[model samples]
Target: MVLQGLTVLNQKNYEISQSIGKNLFDNINEGGFDYVISECQTCKWQIDMSSNVTCIHPLTLLCMSMDA
Candidate 1:
């Protein structure tokens, strides 16, 4: 299962997703997440005022266990 998932990850072109695919997958599976976050700062000053989108942070286990 891991190998198949890894293969899919390898085919991806996104730098962030490819680098952290395993962790993202695990988070979704274990925590039942519906979306993944890919945050890159374009500028130091940032302000998020929109309320239409929802953010769900995966549990620590999902992020940490990705290495295993």
Candidate 2:
């Protein structure tokens, strides 16, 4: 599943945003996927900031795959 522009954070509600972000991060980690691909810069930043897994941009991954 591609979550291209998943906005997990809610700037209006800090506590709720943190809770949602944590849940999302935990679920993603538990899924054991090798890569998290996203097109949105903010999404990438959020994922990276919250979890050990690094999110890669779709175009970057595509270029990498082509090279491989």
Estimate, for each residue in 1-68, the C-alpha lDDT of model 2 and write its tens digit: 32333334455554555565777889778888887888888778877886778899999999999999
Model 2, global lDDT: 0.72
lDDT of 2 at 55: 93
TM-score on alpha carbons, each prediction? 0.23, 0.70
Residues 6-52 of candidate 1: C-alpha lDDT, one tens digit per residue = 23334363344334445444444566544434232211011011112
Off by over 4 Å in 1: 1-19, 34-68
Give the lDDT of residue 26 in candidate 2.
91
Q: How big is the positional error of residue 7 in model 1, measured in Å on the Cα after superposition?
A: 14
Best by lDDT: 2
Cα displacement (angstroms), candidate 2, residue 18, comes to 1.9
Q: What is the lDDT of residue 8 in candidate 2?
A: 45
